[model samples]
Structure formats: structure tokens, C-alpha cells
Target: MKFYITFFAFILILSILIGCNVDQPTDVSTSSIPIDATSALSGGDTTILSESSHAFSTPAPNLSADALEKHLDGDLEFEAIFVTAPAEVNPGLGPIYNNITCINCHVRDGRGKPPTVDEKFVSMLFRLSLPNGENGETGQSPIPVPPIPVPGFGTQLNNRAIYGTPSEGTVIIEYSEQTLTTADGARIHLRYPDYTLTDTYKPIPENVEVSPRVAPVVFGLGLLEAIPEETILTYADEEDVNGDGISGKPNYVWDVVEKRYKLGRFGWKANQPNLLQQVASAYHDDMGLTTSLFPLENSHGQSQLKQNPTSPEVSDEILDVVTFYVQTLAVPARRDVNDPQVMHGEQLFAQAQCADCHIPTLRTGVLPGVPSVSNQTIHAYTDMLLHDMGPDLADNRPDFRASGSEWRTPPLWGIGLVRTVNGHTNFLHDGRARDLMEAILWHGGEAEKSRQMTLQMTTEERDALIAFLESL
Candidate 1:
């Protein structure tokens, strides 16, 4: 009995030593890991499992019946084409404007690309501002200075006009190609776009700052807005005290409704405060339609500016539904979480610190009037704060608190489906990056480290990274 007991003890000790020597994965847990199958649900319960062309156009699956009805009503309004005023059915198009409808710019609720060489300016628009003048105080804690509007042309360039009205200007875009050789000897071609404002209605100042913007995806905005202001602030490292080389800042923009500066949560620069204002501004600026929020015409300062109307062109009800439509659009579920290459790429992504600014997960707080998007765990992959993207991506046009080099960290959810929905792979504020790799390579300033890390990746590793992104 004593010999048998000693032998069992020796066996148990040997087993313990073997367990200690066992190899394990070095990777940390990421959003890509399937935890109760929630990893594939990018927008929590609101996420829809659709890879179709209409992926971005779906209503949130979690919406109530009434809310879904409202979303459908808003969808009609979103697609409604506006004509010149003095007629019925969605009138008040333009004295001068960029597009005739919201759907035209945000095609299928997805992204917009820059106009091709032969195509007209259908979805892209330019923001024009004059150079800032001396404003005495230099050490203001949070300067919320508005862009100095170009005289007669206002803040945006209206490239198209109604009958008897001249357009603010026409833009000519020319591209010069440049080659970048990666560390792995992969040759990538990048197009440098040169824009010239030609054929203006009036002679504009030579120093006008022009910023080109392509319409971003409209889905998943409600979830982004639902993220609490305090939660977003927690991600801001303006001083980079952590030494990770990321310094994100929030853009404080004017809220006409609140009559004070509020945290900007939308637009390329996070220039608009909320979806209501964003939708209203789009109606006013893109289609030249006045709303209760922005009762003035977009062509306010120009000679062709219309007389002040008795009431707003778009009714409050119409505006509300349209805002609700955007706020409730479903985010598409992530794909290929189990794919080996994609899984490997996800690990590499975390290793390169791409998950820092493009934050993998965040939980949303309550968004008033939009219960479908509130209090949900989401994987939008964005910090939703402004970061200096470097001079290469700068427009040299400041909007509110955002400098020329700063841009809001746009959500990466539904990005992989942009091609399926919009039928184009063009990206960035100006649609300069032609593909996903080019977009990654274009990162600089706060993202310079990630860019350098990506550059040093082996060919297989780079392919894995892209495969992971495609899986999203």
C-alpha cells in the first residue's frame, strides 16, 4: 500500500510539470473572438446579418413597430427629390446648391465617391472659408471660432444652380499619380488630386480655403451619438500623457438649437453637433432647402439669395422622421470571424496598436428619442474624436474647434460593405485613397506609428491584415 501511494504521487507531480510546460496563444482577447456569438454582432441587438447591396439601408432590427414605421416614412423623405420652389411635392431645391436630394449624396445610405473625370459633382461638395483675421486673445482654453465665410459665396461652394441663378463656382479636379514602395517591395500608386475653382459667379478671394468632402455612410450614427460625452472624453489624450503617440481632441461646435457650443459628433471634422443638425444642414446646404432649425437660405449672402420666406421649406415632422431614419439604420454584422487568416490579421491589428484610435469596442449610453440605439455594446471601431491626420491629408480649412489637420475618427463598421453598397472603393474625406491598403498607408501624425508598423509587415502579414478588414 505504501509503494502504490508513492508511485501515484510521482505520476501526479509529473503531470503537473507537463501542464506547466504546455504552450498557449500569446494574443490578447479581441472583439473578433466569438463570445456567445456576440463577436459577430457589431451593433448588438440592432445588428442585421446582411451582406447584400442594401446592407446599409436596413432599419434596426430591434426597433419597435411604430419606430420601424417612422423609419420607413423617413426613408421616403430621404429619397424625395426636391425641385425649384413655387411648385408642389418637395419643392425648394436651389438658387444654388450641390445636389437635389439626400439620397443622391448618400447613395443607398452608404458612402459617396469623388466625381470621376467625366462625371459631374453628384455626391461630393467643397467647403469654402476665408483665412482667419487677428482675434486678439491667443491663450483661450477652448476656441470655438467659426470658419470665416467667403463673402457672397458663404461657407460652401454651390456648384449647381436653378434657372436665372449662377452657381457659386465650378471645380476642376486633376490627379497626378505617385508611387510608394512598401518595405515588402509592394508597389502602390497614390493619386494626388489638385482642385481648382473655375468659373465663379463672382470673382472670389484667391486665399479662400477649399475643403472637399465626400458623403460618409449614414448607418450606425445613432450608436455613435448614443456614446456618452464623458465616455468619449475618456479616450481623449490631448497631451499624450500615456506616451502611446495618440492625442485625440473633441471638437466643440456651435449648436444653434442649444445656443451654445456643444461637443461635435458628426461630419468629416465632427463639425455638426447632432444628427438633427446634420440632417437639417444637409437639407439646407446640399439641396438648398430651408428647415425650422436653419430657416435662412444657403445662398444668404449672394446676390441671387432669395427673399426670406414666411416659414421653413421642410416641415418639423419631415425633419424629425428623416433624422430618425438615419438614427435607426442598422449596422451590418461582421463576417468571417472564424476564418484563420482573418483571425490572424485581427491579432496582428491589435499588435500594431491600430486598435488604439480605431477602438474595437464601446458601450452606448441613452440617446434621447432613439431607444433602439441606446444602452448597447457596439464594435464600431472608432474613438469618435479629432486627431491630427498630418499635412498630407489636411484641407487647410479649419471648422469650429477642428484644425485643418484634424479629422474625426470615422467608424469602421460597415466599411467593408461600402463597395457592395456604393459600388466604389474610394475613401477618406476627399475620396483620395483608392483602396483599403492605400487608406491604411495614408495614415500619419497620430497614426504615423501604426502606418510605420504596417509598412514593416511581411507580405503575408499585410495580406492577413487586409483579409481581416475585408471580413469586417
Candidate 2:
């Protein structure tokens, strides 16, 4: 009996020492993945390698039956169109809201576009703020714009409202065209957008600051969530101590669940701490459906509001499912990853210093509730940190610790397929860039070196760089 016990103990020790074999390659040399190629397994085993239009909508291959069921439930709920107040089913749509359902803005779990000149900007909305807020206007020079929830309107402008309440206003977007020449002498036309809120129901302050945020892609988010905070902090150089000219810093946002500040990951400015809070806030600001996180009508203290669906409009169960759906959506696999041109472009990408901020690879830590996202090697290509993007991209809208010129480095995974999935190649925070090349040109501040490097590339090298991005 003693011998048997000792033998079993030895076996356990060996197993612990051996552990599960991990295939997370953390290098960028020849681009040969030892375990699985990024496109073949984008979210590790959770990936759905489909280059079709529905690619972004698929569930990860690694989800368990229970997780998959919840994902399906969330998918239905996400697609459910909401109606105005007094709704018996899926109730409490809006006193004021941006869109009726999550799918309306996201449009196939992908990016949203800025509305055309003739159409009102619905899915894409402007974040409004005043220079140093007070009950009454304060007399100060170069007033600092604090993101106070507006007096009658919230930080976001919801042009659509329910029956009695008037909408904040319709935003008219006009574009001024500018031309740029590539190193290859390729002339590209770029559009600069200007937004004006017309027919204002609630008066907007004269010194208001506007930040436009288009709905971003929702894929491989759960994996992104599972990446340990320590791993992310390793990249944070708030003071640019390394002298890389790219200071990627983490945004510590208030966590509603924990009631404390935590590393911010989701959202355009990395304002929301987690998926639950992001989904819940979207319910309030975008759909005007009060979740437990935000139970007030978005009317900003206006009277004559209609009935709310419930104390919290969406039930906890529904919120959980929706959150799961958004979190577990699979990242589509890379296309043409090994093509010679694509591989060459990848080398150029590193040479250009794009990888300094857009870190190419990361491994997710354990996710307690959803184990499918844990311990997987992913190639999302984002450090999930903030960088000063210069005045060209600045909205002069400060969110928490992020400055007006600072924006989160968006992930490069699945970028090439935006056209195939969302039917447009519009890029950037406001969807102003006409193509991927245009988006690169718009990079300034910390990424100025990389953009300038791209400009210096030979025409063939530029094409190779683009091909590598496309492969991602």
C-alpha cells in the first residue's frame, strides 16, 4: 500500500511538471507558427476560420455545450429589436437612445459606419462635454472640457427619442476632401468630417467638445478580457522610459462590479473596465434600456417620462447571456498568411515600428466563468493601451485618464475583412479613413515614425506591407 501511494505521488508530480503543452509563439521572425497559424486558429482553438461575410458572427470552436447555448440565447437577445416605453416584452427601449438593438449599430457583430450626408448619424454618435463643468458657467480662459453628464442630455447625443420627449438633435456630417501622394506617387483622397447638431431640443453649451465614436467590432473579446493585467502592464510606458517614441499606457477606469479602479480594456478610449460593464452601459446609452448598472432614464432629469419596463429594464439572466455572446464571438482566421508577399510585408511591418504599439501576440490567462477563453495564444495585434494620437485624431474630449489626443490602439485582427463583412472599408474611430492605407496615413503623435516610415517605403514594399495587414 505504501509503495502504491508513493508511485501515484510520483506520477502526479511528473504530470504537474510536464503540465499541458502550450503552443503560444511570442516572436515575429519568419512568421511560421509552431502550434497553429494565426488565421487557422485566431482565438487559439476558439477560432472560426471563415472568410465569408458571416465570419465575424460565428461562435468560437472551443465553447462548451452550455456556453454555446448561452451564446445562442445572447445572439437572439442581441438581435431583438426594442420598442418604446410600456413595452410588455423586451421593454424600455428609450426616452432617448442611439439605436434599437445591439445588432443595429454593430451590424453583423462588425464595425459601424458614419451616416451619409443626407442620413442622420444613428449608430455612430458624438460624445459631448463642456470646458470645466459647473451648475452655472464659470469664467475661465481656455476652459477645460470636463465630461460631465450634460444638464438635459447625457454625454452621448441620442437623436432618437420615445413619444413625448424630444431628441437631443440630428447631427449633420460634412466631409472636406484632401489629397496625399504615396512614396510610389500614388495619389489618395482623404475626407475630413465636421459634425453639427441641428434642431437642438436641449441647448448644447457653446464651449462643448465633441468626440465621435463609431461602433467597433465585437470578436475575440472574451480572450482579450482574459489576458492578465500584469501582462498588459509590461507594455505600459507612461513616461516613455524606453525611448521607443511609443509610450503605450493602461487606462485605469472605475469598475462598477468591484467598485474600484481596474485596468481599462474595452471601448474606444478604454473607459469601461470589463465586458459586463460595457454591455450594460451600451444598454443604457445606446438603447435607453436601463440595466442594473444604470437604472435611471437617460432623459437627464427631464419630467413627463413614460413608464420604465422594470426597475432594471433588462433582467440579469438576459444581461449575462448577452455579455457572453459579445465576449465569446470568434475572431476570424487570417487569410493568405503564408503568401510570400504577405510574409515580406510582415517583415516590413516590424521594420516600420508598427509593432511597437500594436503588439503582435498575447496569451490569455484563466477566465473563471468561461474557461474557453483561457490560456490561449492569440494574435489580436493590440497592446490594449492608450497612446497620444496627435491633433489630427484628437476630439479634445477627455475620458478618465486618457487625454483628448490619446486613443486606445485598436486591434489589427480581422481588419482586412471589414469590407467583406460590413460592406465598407471605412476605418478609424469615426469611420473617416476610406481604406487601410488612409488609416495608416492618419496615424501621428506616438506613431508618426511608423507613418513616416510607410511614406518612405518603395511602392513594392508598401504593397507588401498592405498585404501583410490584409493577411492579419
Candidate 3:
């Protein structure tokens, strides 16, 4: 009986040990575990497996035959170049404009860079606005207002024009270099930019607020738009009541089609409401072409303003197709997600609180007319809300609800591929950051904490952080 009892006790102890092991996993390295399947699919069903230069230009693979055909049609229109009026093919280029075609600015559908030495401004443009005299102090108004337009230049400075027309002006950018030493005694050089306007047809006011914009990547936009407004609003804590030192605020802007205020989703400042409005505004403001949404010329109030034509320069059908094209472009799948260094970098990214504003994962709701991007999981890494990025990076030019020091958190989905696609690593609203690390060092305001944490990281930790970002 004594022997039997001993054996039974041993068996009981063995079973309990097994159960405990099952309940509490051993502290194994995360690298040994399989990567989450969702990590690779940055755009859900719309994610494409491509590391090529043309990655940003691919249509969603899951698009139906009919949708694919329309996307192709829009693709042609996107690349179509317009000349001055009275020509048979693609007329109405510009009386005053920046570029001739959409593809020129958004080369290969990737991000644009500041002009290289001796290079003309092909992808960058300057926004012109006057100071708001009585709209109330900046950042204090409950209701946001548009930037006051400059008298002659409207809201944008058009550097090019058709024959016999005077261009608004040209911008010359000069850089002064500064050096920063990291916590590890490694030094990094940062370039501060100074923008000066010259060759003006008329003098702009000394108080004119100038904001330089480099055209951002056009892929994965549909996924961003599909993210539910409620989902985004949930992340906004303008009061920072959570005491996390991050206050993400939404921008409410005028929607021409809806004729009411709506949540601003696109642009460096989150100034445009939807993809349709964004595309239409690009045609109107960037190209000086008109659609039904913005039928007036960009030079409307100036002496160079032309009479309104019977029909819009860009037809409704073309506008719809182009919008659909951008809506269906697939986001490239993330690379090296399972690599150990990448996994560590990802952890560092989270530990440093970079994920607070650049939120890693979001589930997209249905976007009207675009089934491919709707009802899917994505990792675009943006909260789609404006945050005060500190005074150093401030444009000092407000847009709708965005303060001068505030900017929308740009999506980090395909950021790692910008150099491969666009051939330059220039970044930020004005393209001052020469590379990703420089961009991080320039962070301030709401992002100051994250930047501080980054500054304190060991050299290995910083490299890991960058490796993780590159994986995305």
C-alpha cells in the first residue's frame, strides 16, 4: 500500500508540472516564434508582394475585371500630359501652374523630393497665404478657419505659365548645416532650410505665410480613407487627458461636394477631406486645371484670371476614373518582418513610443465604391490626426484646423522603399531631412518625448529601430 501511494503521488506531481508549463510559457525568444500573418499584409487584401521600383503603381490584385478596367482607364488619364488650350489632345495645360501631369510630381506614384542642385522644381511646390487678422489667436479657436489667401497669388504660387502669362514667382532653397551628438557619442548632421521667393510678378506681403510641400506617396490611400472616422477620433486626445504627452487632433475642412465640413484625411496638414476632393484639388491647385468640384481657375481673382469656360477643363468622367485609380493602388507588403534584427527594432520602436502617433495596425471599414480596400486589416502606421510637431519643424502656416506647428502623421507603410522608387531619401513637409534618422532627430512638440527616448538609445538600439522602420 505504501509503494502504491508513492507512485500515485509522483504521477500527480508530474501532471501538475505539465499543466503549469502549458499555462505559463517559457521565456523563449520572440524570434523563435512564427511572425504574425498580418504583419506582411500592410494593406490587407490590397497588399502586393513587390520590392520593385513599380511597387507603388500596381493595382489591387483582388480587383474585379470591371474595376480593373476602370483603374486602367484612370492610369492613362493620370499620365496624360496637357498642353495650352486650342490643341486637340489634352488641352488646357495652364495659364499659371506647377506641372503638366500628375505623374510628373508623383513620380512612379512614390514620394517626391526637393529639387536637386541645378534641378527645376518638378515635384515640390510652395503654398502662399496671408496672416489671419481677426480669426482669433492660433490654436485657440474652437472652429477652424482657412488660411487667408494672398492677394495676387491666391493660395498657391504657380512658378510656370502659358505663353504671354506671368508666373507667380520662384522659390530658392538654401541649407545651413548643424551637428547633433547622440547619447552614444555618435554625431549626426542636420540641414536647416531657408526658403526665399524671387522673380515675383508682384510683391508678396512680408507677412505672407509660406509652406513648402513635397508630393507624398500616393499608394495605400484607399486603405487610409477606409479607416473609420470613429476609429480615428478614438485616438484623438486634444486635451491629452491620458497624460501621455501626445495630443492628436482632427482637422475639419470644407468638402466641396458635400458642401459641409468633414474630417480632413489627406495632405501634409490634413487639409483635404476625401480622395475625390484631394484629386480634384490637385488638378485645380497644382495643375491650374478645373473640374466640376473646383470650376474656377486658380488665378481667379488676379488680373491674369481668364473667363469661365462653358465646360470644366477636366471632365467629370476623367476625374472619377483618376480618383478610382488612386483608390485601388495596392500597398506593398512589408519585408524582413521575421528577421531577428527587424523584430528587435520593432520592439524598440514600440518601447520608444513611436507607435503612439504612427499607430502600427488599423482595421479598415468599407470605402464606398472601392470594395478591395474595404473591410480589411492594415498596418499603415498613421493615426490620421494632426499633432503639434514642435516649433523647429513648424511651417508657422495653419491649414483649416491644423495649427502652424501641427502636421498630420504621415503613413509609414512604404517609407522604406522611397529611396528605391524616388531615388532620394529627402523627407518631411519640406524635404529637409536627408534620411530617416535625420527625420527622427528633427521631431519636437508632441513627438518630443519619442525623440528624447530615441536620443537616449544606444547605437545598437538606434540601428535596430531604423532596421524595423526599414522592414515596414
Candidate 4:
């Protein structure tokens, strides 16, 4: 009996030791050397430089007389559609909805900044259901079925509604500060979100799962579309080749028009494969604006609001024009990668291994009409996978198979220009991170090790690392 016990103990220890060493490559280079910035950018004009590295450009909107006319026309229509009160005249609105138009949350064609002390932004919250599958494989049923109430927000609390109607109930959040130490002895202080609502029209279900996402930038989407399915799929090696910690998988979405599952490359979980579909979904979900695809209204099990089968907002013309504007919006160029801090930050980013997931460069596929996006390289800085970011950042909600902690690595291109392009600088999914440093401090899960290494660096090293991000 003693011999048997000893043998079991020995096997357990061996198993743990083997797990530690399993994906660790013997060829892993441990040097903390920074790549020379000047040398990296020394040769050639914009074309060659763009091809080799990440300094890619987004296609300019066809500002032809026709296109400009459409933009002007759309701008006016969008403004008029959003600001006006939904009266008995506009019967299609709200059984339950977030806002009337995209502009409410996005502001302009810019990123939404978090609310100040006075009041919160008209933030949009999302709901998700748990998948009955293992390791994100095929399951018994996919797509969120109703009665599976989402957590916290109670199946998407539509905060704003038409006047004289019961405004989708108010939400109040409380915050508490928590300090944590990473593996490499770096200190991090973070604010934790605590939900509290003082008022309510309808009681929330006890177990609905919820997640909040700040509206992201609305530029350079065409380039993302032009990126070929092949190029994007190449990055999805579920069987990790180099034996790194990550094994990213490409999401396949159902394309109603094509009537098949297509490679997904849009949305937080890379769920929407194209801009047109994304815009269509946004119109239906965000504004309660019906379309050809989704003719039904979004109801939170309420009888007051219901779908209007013959609504004018579901017109094909509106969808096409909106999609046209979004696809043509150009991405701004990268900022100061030459600054000593930025250059040093770049080195630290590589050394600390942040680049594994946030791949610095991607070449786009062919686009026939647009010269700017076609066969061009862009610095998107993402692997487009659902990564487990640990409980610290987890919302405890699921999207498709994406667990609470999983999020697509957001593109870093033109992030430095947030202040310039959007006139705001809030960062992260819910606009929680105050700045780039805070964003870095909040990294966990697959990025936890890299974040720890970053925290352990000297102040000068930290500054440089931040500089590199700023340059991007």
C-alpha cells in the first residue's frame, strides 16, 4: 500500500512538470534587445515601407460628386432621423431599444468616451447565453434562445426610449479599488465595476448575463473587408506550430445571402464577416430599425413594442448608402514611432512578448474598385481570436463560444490618434482604462505573463514601452 501511494505521488509530480514544459519551445529567444527604429524604417517610400511593415493606409472614400452627394444626403437624413422624437407617427420604435441612431453612442464617426461624474454616457449593454459545447466545438444548439436571461443588465437594459413612454430603467454603478501584484513583482491598482440600480419599471431576472461594450472607431472598415479570407484564415492555427501559449481559431459565421458559413472577421468576437452585414445588424439591433433580413422588432418579452412588417425604415436604399459611407471612411496614419520612449516601448513590447497575439502587420486581399485597400499591408495589431483575459477583466458573459474573459485583440492602428480623430482618449472595451498605461496594467490571461514582465521593468523602460504604444 505504501509503494502504491508513493508511485501515485511520483506520477502526479511528473504530470505537473510535463505540463509546464509542454508548449515551451527550446528555441525561445530570451534576449531583451530592442529593435532599432531608424533601421527598421530606413529604406524606401510609403509603398515599400507599407508592404514590409504595418504603416498601411485605408482607402479614401470616393468623394466623387455622386458619392459626396450621397454622403451629404445621408448625413442630413441620419441627423433628422436621430434627433426627432418618435411620435405616434413613428410607430416602429421601441417595444425596447437602446437609441434611435448610431450617432448617439458613437458621437460622430469617433470612439465613445466614458461618462464623467455628472452623468453616464448613453452606454449600450449586450447579453449572451452559455453554449452547451466543449472547447468551442459543434453543439446541440447555438444562437441565444430566449428565457436564458442575461446577467446584471437583465437581457440588455435599453436605457433610452421615445418620450412620454417608460424610459428603459436607469442603471447606477458603484466602484471599488483593488490592488494586485503580477508574477514579476509589478504593482497594479484597478477599479472593479459593481452594479446597482435605484429605479426599475420591470424587475430583472435573477440570472441574466450581461456585458457592456463601448462603441469602437468607425473608420477604415473597407480595408478589413478587403483582407482576403485566406490571409485571415492563415493566422488561425488551432494546432499551435511554434508551441506558443496561444492557438487562435477563426470564427465561421452564417452568411444568409451566400447560404453558408463564412470566415468571420468583424465584431468583438469576430462574429460578423463583412461591413454590410455588420451595418445591417447594427441598424436592426441598436436603432430598432428593421431591414430585409430582420423584419421583427427586438422585444424584451414586452407586449408594448412589436415588429412592424411594413415599416419604411427597412428600405434597401438606406442600408446601401449607410454601408457605402462606412466602407469608404479612411484610417489615419500612425503617430510618433520615432520617439525614444516609443522606440523603447516597441522593444519592451516585443521582449515582454505582447506581440504574440497583437501581430504587428497584416496584408490585405484584393479589392477591385478601391486602390487604397487592395493588396495592401496594414498594421492592425490583432490576432482576432477570443482570448481568456482572466476573471479580472471577465464580464462573466458568453458570446457564441467566447467566454466572459475572451475578447478579440483590438486593432492598435491609429489608436494614438483617438484624441485627434475622435477628440477623446478613453481605452479598453468599456472605456474603463484611463490611458494606454492603464490598458497595459489591465492585461491578464494569455497576456498576463507579458503584463507582468512589463510591470517589472524600470520606470524608464515603462516610459519607453508606453511611448511605443503611443507611436502606434
> Best TM-score goes to which candidate?
3
Whose TM-score is higher: candidate 1's or candidate 2's?
A: 1
State every prediction's TM-score relative to the real structure: 0.91, 0.88, 0.92, 0.77
Cα lDDT tens digits for candidate 4, 1-472: 9999999999999997885443221211122112343222211011111221122222242244465455455554444344223544333555456776666665656677556668754644554343333423222123421223333333456666655556456656566787767445566677766655435566665444556677876666666777777776666665567666665666666665676767676776666767778877776666666677667655434543543646545467777766666665545444455566677787788889888778877777766554445665667677766566777787766554455576777777666656655566778787777678778888887778887787788777887887777666
- Write candidate 2's Cα lDDT for 1-472 as tens digits: 9999999999998886564211121222223343445444567767765789987998776676688788989999999999875667777778788898999889899999998767766568888766554322321112222367666666888888877778888777889999878777878788988877778785777777678999999989999999999999999998899898988877777787798878889999888899999999898888788878877767647542555445888888989999999888888778787789998998998999998888888999998798889999888889999898888898877776777788899999999899899999889999999889899999999999998898888889989999988877
Error of 3 at 124 (Å): 0.6
Candidate 2, clashing residue pairs? 39-334, 131-144, 131-145, 132-144
Could you tell me how far off, in angstroms, the CA of residue 229 lies in candidate 1 after the best superposition?
A: 0.5
Q: Against the unseen true structure, what C-alpha lDDT does each candidate score?
A: 0.87, 0.81, 0.88, 0.59
- By summed lDDT, the worst window of 10 consecutive residues in model 2 runs over 20-29
Error (Å) of candidate 3 at residue 355 is 0.3
Flag the better candidate by lDDT, 1 or 4: 1
- Which digits, one per residue and each the tens of the lDDT, describe model 3 over residues 1-472? 9999999999999998996554332322132224465687888778777788987998887787689889889999999999999899999877899999999999999888888779989999999888785443354455778888899998999999989999998999999999999888989999999999999999889988889999999989988999999999999999999999999999999998989989999999999999999999899898889899998889888876677556899999999999999999988888888889999999988988899999999999989899989998899999999999998898888888888889999999988988889899998998999999999999999999888888999999899999988878
lDDT for position 149 in model 2: 66
Alpha-carbon runs more than 4 Å astray in model 1: 1-35, 134-141
Candidate 1, residues 89-115, lDDT tens digits: the string is 888888889988899989999999999
TM-score of 1: 0.91
Predictions ranked by TM-score, top down?
3, 1, 2, 4
Model 3 superposed RMSD (Cα): 14.1
